[model samples]
Target: MSSARNSYDVVVVGGGHNGLVAAAYLAGAGLSTLVLERLARPGGADLVSPLPGAVVTDLGLDLPRGSRNPACGDLASDLVRAVGPTLLQPLPLERDVRAQVDPDTWRDFVSTPLGVTLEARYADDAERGRVAAEALTGTFASLHDESLAANRGLLYRLLGGTASTRGVAELLTQAAAGAGAELVTSAGVSSIRGGDDGAEVSWHDGMSQHTVGARFVLSNVAPWVLQILMGGDEDPATKPEGAQLRIDLHLDRLPRLRSGADPEAAFAAGIVVGSGYAELASAYDEAAAGRMPSVLPGRLQGRGDTLTYLGTHTPARLFADDPQGAKDLAVARALATIDTQLAEPIADRVVHLEARTPQDIEHDLAMPGGHRFHGDLEWPWAPNRARLDTPAQQWGVQTDVGSVLVCGSGSRRGGGISGLGGHSAAHAVLASR
Candidate 1:
């Protein structure tokens, strides 16, 4: 193929949901906008794969709840509502599930042959009072339990959060097309330069290099990746630090419990098995020291024929900067944790297993930190500072970046497949222009 010269009012990079949304809004405003994606398909992590029996399994995050839903109240409710419907589904756990073996700790134990529905509930008054008293003494366990009990409502809200079942990518494609935006896939962005007058974009397909000049450029790629294209003093705030990716394991068969007398009784049920906060802290410490963490916590969900185990991995700085190894270690830890919880051996019953690392997330979906949410709530400055409307100093959705802007999870509002970032970004861009 020969290099094709094209000019558009706006050029959006990455083709992720956010990029597509920005492009759609711009094009809808009658500005000639074009979307460029390196992949053959444009959904990013929201991509889906066909399973047997006409089932489509999403390879990315699960369905996100609606904005009006309690789980999303703290986040962007109205914006999410404007984008689309809330997709929420139950994650079932079965009996004879795996959990940690420590008698003193409930961190990683599988429920017995009976199923346990994990939900957030307030503790009794006596328990609550005792917990409040323990906090004065600085007893960590008591404090943790107390906090958990007091925050049951909040916890429940988070547990009930939603994910996009069909994936954000496909939705974005439709939105772009509806807005009359042109989309080109399998085109890799090599560089983005120039100023507000127009941006010179150089990209390549297998057969040829393609260049375009656009008045505005919106890059949905992670800030770190963007550095490779723009090449200059990079914006540290836009990129994530520490661990950036997460991996989920899918099992072909759900665990079955043998009931001697009641053969008809249901065995396992869906539950979220985690090491809690204390054990998680210990695991993080061990990982920081270049040693394997003994315990890993995970969320368990059942969908028709498969059971999924999802866990967060150690930070990227661990394993001597070996991100892949860190991811593998995280998966190993999660599997081991599951085995311990199960109480019974299951190495032979595992029919299928796959791991996705942070690098894979970045390359495949353009998500920074492999984080499902756009920003981390742990940082003190994170809460008010990082939101859809708030932009970092230099390279951000704001600034003089043009009529183009970011609508992806990487923006201040952060991650998940809610499409709130995209909706908000489009609004911001439209208002500014």
Candidate 2:
């Protein structure tokens, strides 16, 4: 019974979508929960995937089930099985997740570079380029980077199904509030000190510093950010990094393509530009070597007069010297590349251009280098990385501190707009109790 004036059963730091999800569950289960957010509002700017089926059913939420990318098919479902509801309790023995899949498929997927698969699977250059673009999203490597990072990134995106129309953060906020959880915005957490019973969280609300004691702490920040807040060593290499650019266009109308394909259909799938796999590799190399690629690789999407173009391999490091100048260059290059496939220049249709460089995302999200996943994308079945010994570890939310668990994109099943990370962390807490 947490009845102390300044004490709670749980304190969730960072009131993003996942934190809200965790708070909703904890409060729903009769625990005193509090959520602290740095931003004025809880949710980020993007849409979110549907909450896991169990969460939706239990919460009685009216959120619709989003459609999955057919390209992923059964493979995605199989790879995601290891992190299912079983994660709620401690895992006694580590399992070889990769062995669950076919040997040949596993070898090709994990060992072969993504570029090789793109070349072999799709014959048409345009279609192959479109598929290749998905693999490269958020990844700084080329198809040849045998680390399987691109493949891993693509798999994760497909596994997300798709972003739903309604936002998950708002729904989670309502649920948590209804369940007796306190939500506070603009209360940025500064430090977390843990003892045998619980951890004391210190936060500042611009004018005053406040401290609260909690039986357990759930962090919605990346591990590196957590380390810095805990006065740990700063490891620059371990910090998340972003190598992508997002340009939001408020268009008067959709730009017509020279290929005579319907603008609606083409834009719905995404209009990818660059020669082919070879050209994509070149762009990555040029960007890696400190120059914007001559042929900027980008994808354009048009819906109801709004167009969003996402360009890749333009690392945040490139903007260190002049963020404004480099970002302006990226926007111009993205539009120019689209012009190559358009009947008229896309720049002519632009009502307004809002470009978000990697630096911009970092500043907005406080996500280190603005890397969306909080770090390089990781494959689910990594070599000898499975650890399911503890309740938190089984849920993939373990941290250096026993009482603190990561409930953000840094967790095992985190990233993309899914609520699995929060749900798993909440379950871990309940299981321990």
Candidate 3:
């Protein structure tokens, strides 16, 4: 085979959801666009399982988990226009399903006055979290981190919030391809060169190396990868971090909750375990130091054949257990954690169990340290230091490279599967043109 050379109006690197979204917009705008994917297929952390009986699994979580799909602040309107509303299915959480400890057990845990005050604050803030999630409006960029800092508690609600199903990823792939965008998979980009006139991307297509010339290049890789490819000044000092355990399990049926709530009802809601701010802080500290917390901390949500727990990982991933043993232990631990809040062992109904730790995440998704956000998310209020001072940077999608832009999780709006970065980058490029 011969090396290939292609030129496009825009070249997108990384076929993650953001890249696909950007391609769709750019191609729809009548720009000859091409997307290069290092993976066999697109969707990044949206991993479709190969297990015979396994349902689709995601290495990272998508966002805005609400009943209605809002169009503001999230570029949701643009996404709908590009890919159609059918791409997303709203996950309407009917009620909160966080676990509550017995009065006696709770008393033992919160014997101190400080603990009692912290518990009260946590309870009050949980309601605030829910309200903020419900009241999410406008693009996150418009709100700005500084504005939201007035109520610091809303940050997690926004970060943890999202609304969509796996179909969104598939639809984005189809939509981008349908919009006359050329998608090249298994093409690992080696370097990027950008000038005033245009940008050039070089990559190896497994068999041979190839070069792509484009007027503009959109990167969907992590910030560090971007810095390396672009070969610009100072590399980011912030260490990449991720604290998530993605588990895919097939249950015979929803497990009964100890609270006498219907399992389906509980499953439909965002179930919280280990309530209170103290627990959250402790869990973060433990996970930060590479140790599994005494009590698994996070929220649980599931639909149909899939369930995902956020903010929890296996000891094996933390402590360096054998890969297989680690996964098994993690799955076992997850089930045990779930059992703590349920009437019976949810583990009993498990027909199939699969777990992905930070290690699996790093390997499978090529995420540095398996960080879902790509890197540390800076406050929107932080002084503007990027190459461009436009709203794209506020939205967290701007880059130091003039011709190269970002549309990955590392963008300003915070991570998760929301394609705001894609929408932001595409719009910026179109505006510049």
Collision count for each candidate, in order: 33, 0, 12
For model 1, the stretches where C-alpha displacement exceeds 4 angstroms are 1-5, 47-166, 233-250, 257-270, 319-329, 340-348, 366-396, 399-404
Q: Give lDDT tens digits, candidate 3, residues 244-342.
A: 677776878777778888667677664766533444445546655766665665456686656666544332237455666655655665667677788
Provide TM-scores for the models: 0.63, 0.89, 0.72
Give lDDT tens digits, candidate 1, residues 135-187: 11101122234234212222222322422244556755876877788888888
lDDT of 2: 0.75
Question: Which has the greatest lDDT?
Answer: 2
* Minimal lDDT window, size 10, model 3: 48-57
Q: Give the TM-score of candidate 2.
A: 0.89
Over 1-433, each residue of candidate 2 has an lDDT whose tens digit, in order, gives: 1223598889998987888888989999999999988888886544455566667777767786545555345543554554342433343233465656566555555568877876776687766665567677777887778688887776666656543344667787888889999988888889988754599888898888889899999988877888777778778877778887888899899988899999988887666776466678888889889998777887676577987777778888888899888887877777888799999998789899898988898888887788877777654432365656678877777887888888877787776537777887898888778
Error of 1 at 136 (Å): 25
For model 2, the stretches where C-alpha displacement exceeds 4 angstroms are 1-5, 49-51, 71-96, 120-124, 162-166, 259-271, 381-386
Which wins on TM-score, candidate 1 or candidate 3?
Answer: 3
| Candidate 3 ranges beyond 4 A from true positions | 1-5, 47-153, 232-237, 313-329, 380-396, 414-417
| Model number with the top TM-score | 2
